[model samples]
Target: MILGIITDCTHYTSPSGEVCTENHILLRQFKHLSAYFEKTIILCPFGKFDDRKVTTTYTSSNIQFHQLPLVGGNAMKDKVQLLVTVPKWLRAFKMLHRQCDVVYQRFPNNLNIPGFIYFWLQRKKVFATYTGTWSGYQGEAASYRLQRWILRSPFRGPVWVYDEKGKEQGRIRNGFSPSYSVAEWEEETAQVEKRKQRIENGLTTYKFLTVGTIIDYKNQLAIVQACHVLKQKGFSFQLTIVGDGPMKAELEEYVIKNGLQEEVKLVGKQNHVSLRQLYREHDFVVQAPLKEGFGKVPIEGFFHGVIPVINNISMASQMIGANERGFLFDASKPNHLVETLLSLPAQQHLFAGMINKGRTYAKLQTLEAWAREYYETVSAYYNEA
Candidate 1:
């Protein structure tokens, strides 16, 4: 069967007119998922390419790219463009719906809204992957909430969501996204042993790392503040902030202003290889975002044998295994994160079990496993038809 995917995942059209992406996670995921279907049609936003250092390429032979204009924000221009492009979006999904046998819509996305409607009206075999906070948050866009309600309440379409493990009834299923492949996961056992020894021996210098676009919603500034607190407390630790964004300048200035230059290193974005190495070297992955769907960093950290330290979000407790696998803090109070880290010495005894459980979870939710399971779930659901 041919699979159709509509997502906000950005694909880049290079200066040479070739389509590729720096989103290695999605690149690997789509490629692997394509193996299950005869063909795949990916309808996504294609933007002007930034000449980034790292890229995970895609071939047009098997997976076709259906480009859509970018739609975001609440500005007047954004609203006008969103309105004007309605026809393009509708026409695109209408065309795709006829050719594809199954539709995989990545939801809580503006672009996928039209596609979701087109597929749903036709009663096409379809499922959505909503990778955002499912249980509502303090400040969420109306469009986001509307899409969530549509998928969860009105429509009974099967969806792979996050953080709704047991509370999810009917077709609403919990899911996770993976960054590493099975071959790379070969050393998981050995890595766990090394992590156990390091934890049991007690860590003198803690290394904390967070990787993502330096955006406000990401709350990376909170991380820098936590580092400042740790430094003042005379804690010997290093904080590494990876990935670049509009707020990079502000974060840099904050680090310089607070005299956290030595303590906090905002190294921008690194290539895939460098990122993997950084994950392996770090003792913990600190995710302080105000809200998140799955907050994939912890899962990626789990794969590399790095524990998670996250702020309380929808999935925080569940993903952290109720603080058994990792630690959860209050984002409102940055010092809560400081307190969590400071307790490491006394809490060291819980490390081995946590590390083992984390790695085991990561291994089970690999890219292949995610794709395969999604395929199986959607297939089994369609079988009931």
Candidate 2:
């Protein structure tokens, strides 16, 4: 069966960790306005490569969605651009509808009018995986209400959410019998598997790492404050903040003010390989996000057998599960974070145990496994109809 996956700008990468090529017949849908819901996908841009038509059978193995830009021009920027793009997008959707069997969408809501019409008209099955309520991003309460109304429409299909709470809401709010899915990571044992070049425990200090971009939403400042508390209380752990963002300079100042200059280091942005290796050197991982939609860093850390100290939020609560693999602090209460870390009985040893448990959990959900699940569900829905 030919399977077509439709998603927005966010879910960009493939399971194999390669940039999707235009020869892959990937189409990018563009949103018309922040207020209006019309969205359409035209042919992706190519440097020198030409657009390739999709086929039902995978016989044309040389085809790919190569060198296509992930985002079209901002929908609100120019009305002319939006008007011109919609027709091309409609044509692309019509082509895929005739060529492919199933279309899997990972968008959280029915905010794309063109996509909505195409999928609705094609009579092809639609499978969606949602993260959470878009209330925070919708600007105002009325905006969120409007979105909720759209989300509850009957035309949508069986949906999947990251957590049970979200899953339950999906059924009530979206007419979806939601399923739960986990992020996929490589399997690892409690101990780091030694390779050709292994670094001995030569560093005499405990190192902590926090992955993900440095932003206000991530609450890295809270981590720095916790480090200050640890310092005042005589705990001497070194922190390495990975990834870069607008909050870097402010966060650096906070680190300095708290007298943690010697302890905390902002390493800026590192690619996945560097971050993975950095995970090996660190004693644990920490995320202090104000809220999260499935924090993948903890799972990544878990794969590397690094104990993850996560904030107690929806995703973290679901992921950590009664503190089986890590510590969860009440994010509402900032002081609680400091107290929790300070109170750990033999912190390193407790962390090691958590790492083992977390690693085991991370192993089960492979990306290939997730893709297979998504594909099968879409296939069944299309065939049954």
Candidate 3:
């Protein structure tokens, strides 16, 4: 079978003439999914090496990339570029679309305007993965709302959502993004076990990590505020905020002004390999996003045996597993994060069991495993026909 993916994922080329992406998680998925089919055609907006987003390369062995002209941010300036570029890209994509036996369209993207509609019109076997907040959220784009609206009941194929089980919303089903492999999971868990043995003498400094683009909705600032609170109480903790965005400077400013420079570090995006090391070195993964889809970082943290202190989001609630896996805090409540962290040292002893449960849960959430589940289900639909 030939697999065609329509994604809004921006890809950057590397110095060695390789098709690479900063999103190593997506890169792994692409490679794994391509292995299941004779050929995989990726239709996405591609950019040059100067884009500075290169990390891991996508497989070119049995994969063909049909590029779309680079479309940048959601601003009007970015949208205007599409008016002239999208027409030719649509025509090009239509030609590529005919060769695919199945279409896997990742959602809430500018290309989804054409990608989803064209696939649906052609009556192709479409597997839509809504990678954003599936239940909707505040200040969401109309495009996002429109995607959810159309993917409702009787959408002809599965609508993979971030939520656990994706409930009974007709075509909507559970889908999550994964990063680690089986080998990586084993290595991390082994390290976690070793950590339990070493840390029995009791903890010292609490190492917290938050990975994602530095953004307002991501609520990194709130975590910083919590850090300031911890500093005031003379807590021995450091928050390393990984990944860069528009809000990095603002976060840096806050960190410096509040004399939190020593406590909070806004480290820019790291490659997949470095990210694993970061997870291992840290004690806890803290994310309090105002809205989110299924974040892979927590799953990664869990696999690495780091306790996940997540906020009130669907993914967090599902993965917290009645607080046995990790702790959950309300992002809406002011000082809630600070309060949660303050109580952590008191409950530090119970973290090992929680980490074990989290590891057990995350072991099955590897890229290879997710690909197997996705391939089987989507391929079976075609088999039935």
Candidate 4:
């Protein structure tokens, strides 16, 4: 059987005919699906750019890419361009629906709206994965709310969601799962053990990390401010901010102007391997994002036994489990994070236990297992067809 995937993430084709993407997690998920299906076709926005500098690439002869003329942007001109290209996108989806046996659309993406509607109209075997906040629909964009409404309709097939609260959508079969791999869990365990030993030897400075794009919603500035508060309190800690985006300059200015250069470091984006190393050395993963879908950073941090000290949001509390596996602070108040960090040294004895429990939970959610579940869910629909 052939599988077709629709997503907003960009896919790049190297001169050597290799599929490359900046999203390593998506690439890995595609690779896992490739093993189960006879062939897989990824339908995403494509651009003709040199991918030689890109570190992550997926090279599989069985996997083919069907690039769509879907130039995505939020600007007014880009919106007009998208409207003009709607007819072309619909035609492409109709063709894709006929060619593939199963179609999987990643939700919360406007690019897939046309494809999803066409596939539903054709009565095709379609499944979806919603990797967004599933708690309350309030404050979300109208398009996002519309997508959620479509997924919840009785017409949609089995849907897998990252948040357990998504099960409330009783009209559709919603499954909850974490995105991780066995190799990742094993590496995290090793790192956690090494860090545990170092902590036992009495390390001086506590290392805290936050991984995500430097966006306003991500609230990297709040993290920096909290670090500043900690520094004022004479706490010996270092906060390393990873990932890059438009707000990099603004964040740098905040760090420099606040005289927090030594307390906070913006390491920019790093490859998967480099990130794994950082997770190993860091003592805690601190994030106060305004919103999150699945909170993959916390999961990745949990695997490495890096206790997640995150904001008290739906995704964070759900992933970390009521502060048992990790700590949670109020995102609305920056001082809450500072207070959480200050209490860490006093609770140092509880670190090993939390790490062990987190690793145990992460072990159960492997990519292999997720693929198996996905295959079963899709095969049921195929059988019905």
Candidate 5:
């Protein structure tokens, strides 16, 4: 039987007009699997948005986009899958099953129940890969509990996780053992590197960058408030917020209302070229997301030698690593962020050390490495079966 690999919400085209997904945790895993099943993989886009338009990047041999049904505008909740037409999803399912004997899907969200029902009824071998629980959605613990139900399902195959922490979180929430050993991940990309800009007036100002959308949960207001506090302390610095979302109007109002227009810039969403340039230009990336599954911003910022100043939550706390690689702050506390920023310039040498450490870390993870591991796992599974 020809081996067919299937994925949901895993492929993204880069800004350079290449069909590469965002190089976060799940994308890294998908890239690995793509290389492994070079010939038999079929990919589906289950994400809510696709800003870039690079459909041609899929390696021709195995890739397809099965548009996932979007739930209503509000934050996602349970029974969301019921709103979508199952027949359309089923057509994609049937197509995937017909092409290959084994199917692999990155799970959580609405696809869990439908995927399980389809594969079980068809008697197709299925693998459920869990990256992290859906924290972006509205409902709390019960939402995860519902997703975990499929994890314990008999049809669920080898569950792939990024780190032991990810596995533990899944197990704690779902009460299931990880079916396979986890893989090491790093955040490095071959995108065009931005030439470092020289800050002629040096050593006095602390510049921080906040990437991603200006959504409410991103907690950008906290950063602005912190910058205001830092400015009051005679600290000369700027906080450049990259990316745009619906919260733009509200955030702009807040910045103007507080008279922080000079100190904070709502630069709006930038393309990849500009984004890399932003990373190179800033001393560090500030991430204050209220919640995150696994933060790729910190890793991506570190990859470019920009230290990440992240909120103490989710994987950001674990990845910061004893403040050696980056700094973690209480996102809920603006004054704390101000204090950290004030203290950072004094540790210039330390910051340099962290950047060096980040460079070393970046080399350890590459597209080639990710692809190889995924291929071996799939090949071994099919071989044994």
Candidate 6:
């Protein structure tokens, strides 16, 4: 059967005849989906093809790319452009719907709205996976709210959300999982064992790692402040901030001004492979995001037996199994994270058990396992008719 995927993700072609993406995870998902379906059509906005900037490696013979006009943007001019261009894309989506046996759409995307409406109008079999926080949190874009409303409508088919709480709202489980292979897991496990030995012998300094784009929404500044509190309280720990964004410069300035240049380091962005190596050396993965959608970094950290210390938000708390699998802090309380960090060394011995439980949980949610779940869900719905 032909599987059509409607998304807002950009697709680019390299000058050397290679299909590439800036998002390695998305590229991996596409490759996995291609393996599951006989013919997979990726419908997305086509960006400028440049070999020089291409970073992600992904190419599949069974996968076909269908570029459409760029649909959503934040500016007023972009909205006007979308108004003038949507009709043309609507016709393209209708044609795509006619060729597909079933349609799968990524939610919280304005570009997917026209395609979703077209599928509904034609009574096509379609399912969606929501990629944002399912807690109905405020500050979400209007387009995202509209998309959620449409998916929750009775007329819509099965909708998958990343949080367990979403099940109460009629959303299915779309759990976040890591993409680590068995070999990688074994290697990371060895590193974790070595680190545990060092912790036991008092030969290691506590290492904290946070992986995500540096943005206001991610609340990296909160992590810095929390670390400052820990330092003032006489805690010897190092924080490594991964991923880069607009907030990097400001965060760097704060670090330098507070005499935390040595304690805090902004390492910019690293690929998945590099990140796995970095994860091996860290004791805990700390994140204080104001909002989160599944928070995959924690899951990824778990695979390496690194404990996650995250804010007590809905999706994050649920993913970490409400502190059963990892530690949770209240971002609202300034001293909460600091207290948690300061208390870690005294409780370091208990980390072995926590890491074991977390690793076991992460092992079950690999990319292959998730793909099987996704394929089964889509296949069941397709066979219903």
Residue 378, model 5: Cα distance from true site in angstroms: 2.9
How should the candidates be ordered by TM-score, best one leading? 3, 4, 1, 6, 5, 2
Give Cα distance to truth, residue 48, candidate 2, Å: 14
Candidate 2: count the clashes: 12
TM-score of each: 0.93, 0.72, 0.95, 0.93, 0.76, 0.92
- What does candidate 3's lDDT look like per residue over 1-385, in tens digits? 8988888787876778788777788888888878899999888888766755637877559988887788767789877887888787678668766788888888878777676667677887888888888888778888889878777744578777887544755556777888888888877656888888756668889999999988888989999999999999989999999999999999999998999878788879999888888988898999988888897778888888888899968778788888998889998888888999999989978888988898889987888988888898887766886
Query: By TM-score, how accurate is candidate 1?
Result: 0.93
Question: Which pairs clash (backbone N, Cα, C closer than 3 Å) in model 4?
Answer: none
Q: Write the per-residue lDDT of candidate 5 for residues 253-372, one digit (tens) a residue.
A: 978987788888988766555676787677779988876765667766666777888888766655777788888888676378777877876677676567767666555445565455
Q: Name the runs in model 4 displaced over 4 angstroms.
A: 48-55, 74-76, 164-179, 381-385
Tell me the lDDT of model 3 at 113.
65
Per-residue CA lDDT of model 4 for 15-70, tens digit only, reads: 77777878887787778877888888888887776734444788777888878775
Q: Across residues 220-336, which tens digit of lDDT does each residue of candidate 1 receive?
A: 998888788888989899899999999999999999999998888988778778898898789889998877887778988888888899988777787888787899899887479
Q: How many Å off is the CA of 381 in candidate 5? A: 3.5
Encode model 6's per-residue lDDT on 171-271: one tens digit a residue.
Answer: 45555644665566666777777766767676347899999889998999999988888788788899999988899999999999999988999988887
Global lDDT of each candidate? 0.83, 0.57, 0.83, 0.79, 0.62, 0.79
lDDT of 6: 0.79
Give the clashing residue pairs of candidate 1, or none: 132-293, 243-268
Top TM-score prediction, candidate number? 3
Error of 4 at 373 (Å): 1.0
Task: Give candidate 5's error at residue 366 in angstroms.
Answer: 2.6
